[model samples]
Target: MDFEKLIVWQRSKCLAVDVYRKFARCGDLGFKDQITRSALSVPSNIAEGMERYSDKEKVRFLWIAKASCGELRTQIIIAREIAYIAEPLAEKWITDTRELSKMLCGLINKISD
Candidate 1:
């Protein structure tokens, strides 16, 4: 299966891009880097998993992607609290990460079974 064809992967990729663009001018380099890396990991892990030959490997990567979703969500919440992100945008991203995590879980279960 092509990871690009997966809705979760596609949405995650878009989210990462949005995060990068949104934080491009951020003054706090450490926070920006951490958040962006987590955001990027979602789709990256998904793609890596889908490209793997074994189900075990695929499930492992999906789990990593799900973990990244959680990490990204936490960062988004912190960003909003710190005023680095706007309320509306932070909420949207948080919602997106939740959905992506759920999607990754579903994929992992399906692949495992």
Candidate 2:
């Protein structure tokens, strides 16, 4: 399956773009780079997994993508706690990340079977 056709991938791509745009004005290079890279990893890993030749390989990459979602969520929460991100946007990002994580679980389960 084409990863682009997957809702999880599409949502993750949107999340990454939103994150990148939101942090564009930030002065903290370290935090910005970390969060943005994690955000981008979600969709990149998804696409790479889908393109893999074997289901096992795909599942491995999907697991990595799933972990990246948690990593991104943690960074986002930290950003909010530091007052770098406002409440509303952080909430939205958290929501999206949670949903994507669930979606990834579902996909992994199906692919594993």
Candidate 3:
């Protein structure tokens, strides 16, 4: 199946775009770059894994993507604590990451089967 057609990939892609848009006007370049990169990694890895020839490779990439979601969630919490992000926005981002991570786990299971 095409990665683009996968709901998890689509959700992750949208989350990455939302993260980029939300951080567009922020002044903290270091934090912004880190968070955006982590956010982008989720969907990028998903796509890369989906294109792989073996299920093992695909699972590996999905695990990476899942880890990226955790990284992104941690960054969001730090951003919120440092006042770089609003509480409500951070909460939403954290929720998104949680859901995305769970979806990644489900996908990984399906591929590993």
Candidate 4:
């Protein structure tokens, strides 16, 4: 299966790009770096997982991607609380992360079975 064809991968890639753009000028280097890395992990792991030769390896990477989604969501909440992100945009990102998590879960289950 092509990871690029997966909706979860596509959405995660977009989310990572959005995160990078959103924090392009952020003064908080630590927070920006952490969040962006977490965001990038989702899609990267998914691609790596799908390209693996075995189901076990694929599932492992998908799990990592799912974990990254959770990490990214936590960072989004923190960013909002710190006022580094505006309410509306933060809410949208939070929602996007949640949806991405769900999509990842679905893909994981499908692949696991």
Q: Please provide, for model 1 over 11-109, each residue's C-alpha lDDT reduced to its tens digit, 9 standing for 90 to 100.
A: 999999999999999999999999999999999999999999999999999999999999999999999999999999999999999999899989989
Better of 3 and 4 by lDDT: 3
On a 0 to 1 TM-score scale, where does candidate 1 land against the true structure? 0.99
Candidate number with greatest lDDT: 2
Model 3 worst lDDT run, 10 consecutive residues: 25-34
lDDT of 2 by residue, 1-113 (tens): 88889999999999999999999988999999999999999999999999999999999999999999999999999999999999999999999999999999999999999
* Stretches > 4 Å off in candidate 3: none
Clashing pairs in 1: none
Quote the positional error of residue 14 for candidate 4 in Å.
0.4
Q: List per-candidate RMSD values in Å.
A: 0.5, 0.5, 0.7, 0.7
Candidate 3, residue 50: CA error in Å?
A: 0.2
On the 0 to 100 scale, the lDDT of residue 18 in model 2 is 95
Candidate 3 lDDT, 1-113, residue by residue in tens: 89999999999999999999989988889988999999999999999999999999999999999999999999999999999889999999899999999999999999998
- Cα deviation at 44, candidate 3, in Å, is 0.2
State each model's CA lDDT, in order: 0.95, 0.97, 0.96, 0.94
Candidate 4 C-alpha error for residue 93, in Å:
0.9
Worst 10 residues of 1 by lDDT: 100-109
Best-first order by lDDT: 2, 3, 1, 4
TM-score of each: 0.99, 0.99, 0.97, 0.97
State how far residue 22 of model 2 sits from its true place (Å): 0.4
